[model samples]
Target: MENQNLNKILSGEKLSIDEEMVPGTIHLVDLEGTLNVKKESGSQSNIILQPQPSSNPNDPLRWPKRKKLAQFSLLWFWAFMQAVAVNWSGPIWTLWTETFDCTYMQLNISSAICFIFLGIGCVFLQPTAMKMGRRFVYLGCTIIAIVSNIIGSQGNSVQVLYVVNLLSGFAAAPVDSLVEISTTDVFYQHERASYLAWFILALYAGSDLGPVACGYIVETLSWRWCYYIQIIIFGVLLIVQLFYMEDTTFERIDRDDLEDKIIQQMKSRETILSAVQSGQLSQERVNSDEKLNAIVSVNNSINTDDDDESVDSSIPMRTYWQKMRLVETEYNDSRSWLTIFYRPFFLISFPAVIWGGVVYGSQMMWLSLLATTQSEIYSLPPYNFTTPQVGLTNFGALIGSLFGMAYGGPFVDWITIKLSKRNNGILEPEFRLWTMIVPTIFNAAGLLAYGLGAAYEAHWFVSAGIGQWLLGFAMSSSGAICLTYSVDSYPKLASEGLVLMLFIRNCIGCGFTFAIQPWLTRNGLKVTTWLMFMLSIIINGSFVVLIKWGKDFRRATKNNYYKYSDPMFGELFKK
Candidate 1:
């Protein structure tokens, strides 16, 4: 904004950019004398990227280390609880069928219904969080969890359980749609991949971890104890949330406000310096020159520590108490979602969004199908594993997830930093896509192993257990990579894009859950898995196409995003 030519570009006026500038490249730093973002790396540059926090110490990006951890932990636990509601039931099907006098198919249909409503619920819940306040949604979702769990524990009829589960699914939706957005609201660009990965970790752990407990409870105590455990967890989280889950939703673009203040101060300093040099003001009349000179001397000497302290003393900060408020300012009229809910659907035309959704949703659908298949397999035939052992099978997934959590999240961060440096910090979204190959290979392997082993009546551990760990690793890694790519590339539309992905993924999940039984029974596990391997290969291999043409896709969208879309939405992305 301080540079005249760049200001022209930001103001909707075209200045012919240099030939070196590409469609996918971002101009990260604006400091004078700093190295330009270019196509090759050499010497290191001492500059931070833009869209950074204001000096107003209240900015969440500027928050202290401990506060960041605490805030992230709170959202993570809530997300965990939401996911638990969906998968905890995986272990209780036997109890449910016996207690409610229903068939497995009925429970399958109910699960499918829950999946559908999970997306449906997000359609409303997401926009509410976007428009109203995150605090309100967090509180409401917690209350819903408490109430739904209570109802689930008491419900004895199939219809009643279905209703309770549907409500539970609804309550879980915000954790999906809001957590990423909320995390982005607080964390910086460099930290986003790690934090977002943790969110995915929480989600996967919540779903995968619950069956372990559910199996033991249903076998020893009662199936109702699953709901009781959820209630206790939610009760603790609810109390913590009342005090800790500060509203992270605000126009962080308020850096424009902060920048404007800085510019005004700069002009005053220039004026004072000019007066001092020109002798318009005597030495007795002004002390501003001495302060300005001290700042200049420190900068010239490269005493970075003194420079930071001096700048910190000059910059304004928001108080600790003020940062805790639920809403910082009146809602911007432009943020109104009267038409913004449809924005993500429009973004579906982008290749990055499509490929990411494919990699993510396909794996998610595969996982969902296995929950039923794994349970049904071990319950019968040569294995006849006890409920506790059935729960233990999830340990395979948990182990894989732990590995993915450890590997995928940090790997993306490391590779991105390396790639960014290699590219002279001129990042393209495709840099993140390289690591996705790991997931692609394993996605196919997992499906094939699980399906064939089961079809041939191979050992349960060989078929279901080992294969789940591989599939779980693939699913977790792919989900983290794709989502991090989408957000890094087009942060303004990330929430909408993610919601669209969720909606599609869940729809696919519902379809797969509905078909898995018939598919397995008719085609046998070997053939069904063979088809899955082929599909996984096709879906994951397509990442090559994105890597090749992703920049073009991003270019196309940038050209049309503001020009063809609603100005209200368009303006939100203005540089």
Candidate 2:
């Protein structure tokens, strides 16, 4: 049976519930209620649990809802604080020019350095997190953030500022990549988009609203106080994490064959029950019972030792201190450090994943554009806005992002289910691509309004209010939708896929930041904005192509996916 299943997959067959596995493919919706896989146990019971939970009490998927939320809340707050540190310097760029006697270009270079380190950090830190466990990395990054902020508070030169951003960027790397993976660690597939939306919200809130508070701090206190406050907040966070943050890293054995057996047994049991109810019990019914027992026996024979231990009630659950331990070695991926470090690079061949990176990276381009120009544009002749006023402009993006979060998170999840039902109860990763249409339109329109309004010297609302709000919506929505799509497509590689996505995203951000001043000087606002608008459309509109051919891409890569998934297939180079 297993050999036949493998044959079907190699032959490019459409995926079915009982068929061989494809990395990005799964049976998500069951409208007829025929498949006997584990389902969500409520009104929405048709939703199948993707990467179904194991029988082990210690599995992160089986954790209590409140426990999951508590851990998520800590990571969420950590991301928010780290983002605030990365962005707080933006509002004070003008003040820093005088204090450090630096050029605006030099300050932009500092921002570019931060972006460089952010991408580099994802590549270097992910393997460590995969090995030492998520808790160890989170706590370690918090400590590094505290010390970096302390150094930043004492900065007296442009060079010192560069060093501070470098460290801060590395410390905050997990915010972009690891948070999503950690969120997936506990949440079911059906619940992920909504929570991942929350992660985006926390990220944007910090980048946008952090400037608001920083503007006020620079007005009343000094720029140094910005870092001082972060130092205090991070101190508190580290304490809370030490006591409460349990590691979510867990190793799960493949249970697909066992699940297939269970599904078959369920069908046979139903047949026997119906025969008995109709008073038609016969040799066939007895044979069905015998077949069920044989299926159970086959399943038991193949169960790994770890599976047997999971069902052993004699073993106690982990103790509180054990759960709170800073490092977890038991659940390590067992690959050499270099293997995990280089894995994301191999995913560059994955079409859907590369598209996801481009979609997400575009948001960072707009974000970098805003950061590079927000102070420069608003502080000029017509507006003559103060630092605090420049900071307040981000409020429009903040409000827009909140609306975007709702649409991208829960709304996307809801739409996916509806579309799956319409497709005869089979969910395709392409369903989420439909959400991109709204963002693509908004993104283009926002760039036009923002650039042209400034060129024509129209009302501030034309650019900052209407334009920024739209950009905020695009940034938030496109980010969540694309990320959810990539993970849904290749869940087995969620961690590695996200790392490459962020690496692409931050590299785009860095390159754009370095070029923003030169690009603006060379072309001026109107021409630059038009060019950007065209670029945004081209990159974001690729969703249409993906929607048309995404499944084919996943199909083409089945052999590659399986090869990389195997622990021993490439051990020669992995060592």
Q: Summarize candidate 1's per-residue lDDT along 330-436 as a digit string, tens digits.
A: 33224556455666677777667677776777876787766787677777777787787777777878778777876678888777767766765456778888987
The collision pairs in model 2 are none
Give lDDT: candidate 1, residue 232: 95
Q: How good is model 1 by TM-score?
A: 0.82
The TM-scores of all predictions, comma-separated, are 0.82, 0.89
Mark the regions of model 1 whose C-alpha exceeds 4 Å error after superposition.
Answer: 1-24, 27-47, 254-334, 564-567, 570-575
Q: Write the per-residue lDDT of candidate 2 for residues 457-476, one digit (tens) a residue.
A: 89988888989899989999
In terms of lDDT, model 2 sits at 0.82
lDDT of prediction 1: 0.69
